[model samples]
Target: MSTLEIKDLHVSIDTEQGTKEILKGVTLTIKTGETHAIMGPNGSGKSTLASTIAGHPRYNVTSGSILLDGEDVLEMGVDERARAGLFLAMQYPVEVPGVTMTNFLRTAKTAIDGEAPSLRHWTKDVKAAMENLKIDADFANRNVNEGFSGGEKKRVEILQMELFKPKFAVLDETDSGLDVDALKVVSDGVNRAAEQNEMGTLLITHYTRILRYIKPDFVHVFVDGRIAEQGGPELADQLEDEGYDRFLVKA
Candidate 1:
């Protein structure tokens, strides 16, 4: 079974000043076919947790450990972690001026799958995934997010997730900066992927709109760089109504 475990994770980031801890004693685990939602305000360390899991060089795990399928993740580099079935979709995707979506996807697929697909099969797979997401065929040739809209960037991230089919995924703010139509398309693409695979999804977002489409099994509240609360889907409702005001008082 695919499983990701985070135990007492404390991530400190170095800046102009000294190091500052972003994730404080955070512990969580997700298994195949499970979806976990992480909700927090801006600067609550949600993105830091996602970046650290993906092996961002800037974030240091000062104390604690991360494991994927019982293997130490800290021992592996970013590429190694990806090869081991960990994927992270960023809140803001970077633009690569010369990289076409097709080229990027093909290269990533070959690396993640550990084998190159036949040309015809590769085209078919790519086309099928794009078609399901209603992405224009021309998007295949467009440079990776060079001038794409905010929604388009998020959709491209979902497309990558579909093509790579990682065992565990950390999606940071996948629903942010998206309009209603774009949100539906991106959400549909994500559901299409998660529905077909026994995916372990750790969806990090501020709002509940995306959750309406993906339906998380667990909702976690991140406050003061730690998990202040956790519960089933109903917890999302509570947060929407009660807000983090109570959490600030208790946390």
Candidate 2:
């Protein structure tokens, strides 16, 4: 089994005012086939952790290490990190105006695998995945995420994950802006990837609503850039009832 390890990670970013530390000495590990949920209040560095893992340049690693199977993740470029089997589904997916979804998917698949997929099998796979995600066939010809609703954008993100089959997926508030039906569809896609590929997940969210669909093996409460508590699925249930009020008070 592959392992993604974060050891004493401290990340910061420069804002208009000054350089602000977002993650303070945070550490965690994820193994393929495990699902870890990070629930927290706004501005608690959960997204920063996700972005850092994806190698976003905006977040600087002031200290600590991110390792995938003992290889230094922090040393890799963003595309290099993705080729290493790390994926991030952004909360607000950006629109790619000039790129068609079909071309984009195939090109990305080729880049990640270091070889182009056979035309016949690639077409079949793309069609099946889009259908399963309930995305319209015409979207294959449309520009990536352009003019799509929030739910549609999120669905496309999952489509990428399902196709890419990354070793670990960092989903940053994927359930946000999705309706109950859309939520189920997205959650099912994530579960399918985990079951089929043994993909580990680091799910970041604020509410327990998504937890009802994507069951997590571990729940971590993030407060003030640190994990305040960790527990099993029951911890999510407790958060649903008690909320992060106590954690905020302590922070």
Candidate 3:
């Protein structure tokens, strides 16, 4: 089974004031077919953990380790991590002005798989995946997220997850700007990816509303850059009702 392990991870960034630590000591494990939801308030270092795992240059790993099936993830570069089956769906997906979605998707799939997919089969797969996400056919020809709405950008991210089929995916607050319908559609796409590929998922969010549609096998409450508590789905319900006041007080 595919596994991603984070052990006492500490990350920092160079701010205007100087270097500031973000992730204090985060340790977690996600195995194939297991979904882990990370819930916390703003500035709690949830995104730091995600970005660190994805090899964002901005975040410097001050200590600890990240392993993919016992392989040292910390040694891999950003693209190398992608090839190692690590995918990050950014909260704010950037626009690629000149690149069409079709070329971008195919190129990315090729890079991850190390071989070009059959054009005929690739086209068919893309069409079906887009249909499942309610993406229009014309989007394939459009510039990637050039002028797409917030919901549309989020949908495109999910589309990438479906097509690339990463071993582990870090969805950084995917539920941020989605409406109820958009949320459900995006959630369905995520569910499909996990179920079909047995892809391990690490879902980061501030609110518990998303847990309703994308039920997590594990729930971790992040506070002050560390996991304050962890439990089953019922923990999410408790957090929904009680909020993070207790955790904040402890922090």
TM-score of each: 0.97, 0.99, 0.99
Summarize candidate 3's per-residue lDDT along 1-251 as a digit string, tens digits: 99999999988999999999888899999999999999988999999898889988889999999999999999999889999999999999999999999999999999999999999999999999999999999999999999999999999999999999999999999999999999999999999999999999999998888899999999999998899999999999998899999999999
What's the residue-level lDDT of 138 in candidate 3? 99
Q: Could you give candidate 2's per-residue lDDT for residues 45-138 as a string of tens digits?
A: 9999999999888999999999999999999998999999999999999999999999999999999999999999999999999999999999
Which pairs of residues collide in model 1?
none
The positional error of residue 32 in candidate 1, measured at the CA in angstroms, is 0.9
The per-residue C-alpha lDDT of model 3 at residue 42 equals 92
Candidate 1 — which residues are off by over 4 angstroms? none
lDDT of 3 at 79: 89
Question: 1-251 in candidate 1: lDDT tens per residue?
Answer: 78899999999988889888889999999998899999987788999999999999999899999999899999999889999998999999999999899899898888887888788988998999888777889999999988988888888889899888889889999999999888888888777777788878999999998888889999999998999989999999888888889888886
Per-residue error (Å), model 3, residue 243: 0.7
Misplaced by over 4 Å in model 3 are: none
Candidate 3 accuracy as TM-score = 0.99
Output the number of the lDDT-best candidate: 2
Clashes of 3: 0
lDDT over C-alpha atoms for residue 134 of model 1: 74
Where does model 2 exceed 4 Å of error? Answer: none
Better of 1 and 2 by TM-score: 2
Error of 3 at 2 (Å): 1.0
